[model samples]
Target: MTQLTQNNGQIKNNYCVIDLETTGLDNLTDAIIEIAVIKFDLDGISETYQSFVNPGREIPPFISDLTGIFDKDVLVAPEFNSIIPKLKEFIGDSILIGHNVGFDVGFLREFGFNFEGTIFDTLDLSYVIHPTQLDYSLTGLSLF
Candidate 1:
């Protein structure tokens, strides 16, 4: 584990960043259509994994517009089940980090990817790092 300075103090960390593009906001009803995960050491992205998942449903128009991932794009792609083994291997013993991690974690949990590692939400972290900033979105943080 690597020690990263947390708000309280230094924390031992084994970090991986995850970002999932889903069909919608409701985890109970929506599904993941694209997944991106990258393992990071102090240097940076040492390993990466990404895939388009077939959600078994139409990619909603707005979602397609936003993601540029239409139904046709994933028609022949493997679904979530096939992706799990590799994902588990890549994420072993690593803390998860993301811009809004809860949303990704919720969707992933619903699909049975039981990740029992520490989760660090950058949005939450931003509150401690840039407390006075008006926007905490990734783009906003980038502009700082």
Candidate 2:
């Protein structure tokens, strides 16, 4: 994994902010059950994409309760592969930005998605720029 520190490494267009809620936190053992993408084109136009997927595995009751995404809700929904094209379109040439975002990128890599360009990790930047803060979670940052 290469850290994109050079000025040349920054993305020049198509910025995207992505978030996912999964059945489990473990990247290897879990799958994305829901995803939300906020896309911003170079011209400052923005769009949004979201989907709920039926992970073949059963979701823990606790997670289902928290997300309100029961098995029945996604039983007939499209799988990740079905939505890859739209995702690719939404992510075109954009730097992916998210809070604690590596797992999402890792999962995309595991699924054979070729993600090039830069990644601006809000969590990492927040930690570095705001070292006095005690929490870096999305909710935590929002409260700051």
Candidate 3:
């Protein structure tokens, strides 16, 4: 990994990191099971929001195993649409940053998020910073 000083890094002071745990990969077919957003800057995290969404369908065993979020966990939770207002309010106009932002944004778009903010993908940044690494997944990078 390349060393990056605070003054030399490409960190965004006006950004909100977004992530979504969905029922599956297909944005057209699957539903968002969970949502998390963090509003932060150089100082630290200013705000954070997370919620489990009722997908109105079964949570596949594979996804449950991977995310550790099962159907029972979200049974009494609010639906995706119900939390859009709060989610948008928290995100505001900040740039979006995520590991695979496109995938998260694609899923958001399906739920009518229609976000127009700029996006930064940490996965792509990982490839540029550590091109020789065998894995680029979030967990893989952490362990490496």
Clashing pairs in model 2? none
- The parts of candidate 1 lying over 4 Å away from their true place are 5-13
lDDT ranking from best candidate downward: 1, 3, 2
| lDDT per residue (tens digit) for residues 1-144 in model 2 | 232343675536567888888887777778888888897765554788989987887889999988889888888888887888889877887778888788888777665566786777888899898899998887787898
Residue-level lDDT of model 3, residues 117-138, one tens digit each, is 6777999999999999998999
RMSD of every candidate to native, in Å, equals 3.0, 4.0, 4.3
Q: Model 1, residue 33: what's the lDDT?
A: 97
Query: Once model 2 is optimally superposed onto the true structure by TM-score, how far is the C-alpha of residue 92 displaced, in angstroms?
Result: 0.8
**62 Cα displacement, candidate 2 (Å):** 1.4
TM-score of each: 0.88, 0.85, 0.88
Candidate 3 whole-model C-alpha lDDT, 0 to 1: 0.87
